[model samples]
Target: MKFTEEHEWLRPEDDVIVVGITQHAATQLGDIVFVELPEVGTEVTKDDEVVVIESVKAASDILAPLDGEIVEINEALPDNPALVNEDPQGEAWFFKIRPSEPQQMDEYMDEAGYLALIS
Candidate 1:
């Protein structure tokens, strides 16, 4: 997945779309306390705020990557937000989506492209 400074990450995998926070995001967010996930089957639009990840310092919204219905969420994160801190690319994933607009990925950067922006 590639990331933006906004803390959104997007990865296309077959029929499903994987979404989450970047490692830089998790580090900046600090110690997380709660994770508010959207209900499965809810229709979401591109760039809409879908998840709320709260840290001891502040609360931040996680924006949806593309327009789609939320197929699933990471149930474990609500109880353990540190999973995001522990493994931003693994167990801490925020949600799984089936992007309604296939063109969305084309609008975003590749891993190298994103790294260039961050670097």
Candidate 2:
């Protein structure tokens, strides 16, 4: 798993990459109430605003960490947004993307670095 400065996490799974916000991000958001996910098959570039999350505190955008095609989104989020707060790095993952440039993942930090960043 790799983590971005924006608090997004990416886990390579088979041929795709699973993407989601870190536990730190979910805690900061403060009780997510809504989620707007990108449609599957949509093309995205690095830093593109792909998912919108609304919480009691504020609404935030989840950016694409790499150029890729959004192959699947977690359909459960729209109905149960609180899942983000419940299991941010697990079942609450936002989407799976097929990266056009898989090597771009190397630019992200490891778990230790991410922990240091949050600390």
**Which candidate leads in lDDT?**
2
> In angstroms, how far off is 58's CA in candidate 1?
0.5
TM-score of each: 0.94, 0.99
In model 1, what is the error at residue 14, expressed in angstroms? Answer: 2.1
Task: Give the Å error, residue 55, model 1.
Answer: 1.0
RMSD of each: 1.1, 0.4
lDDT of each: 0.84, 0.98
Clashing pairs in 2: none
List model 1 lDDT by residue over 1-119, tens digit each. 65655767877778888888888788889988889999999899987899999988999998888899899899999888889889987789899998888777777877787778777
Give the lowest summed-lDDT range of ten residues in model 2: 56-65
Worst 10 residues of 1 by lDDT: 1-10
lDDT of 2 at 55: 99
Q: Which regions of candidate 2 are displaced past 4 Å?
A: none
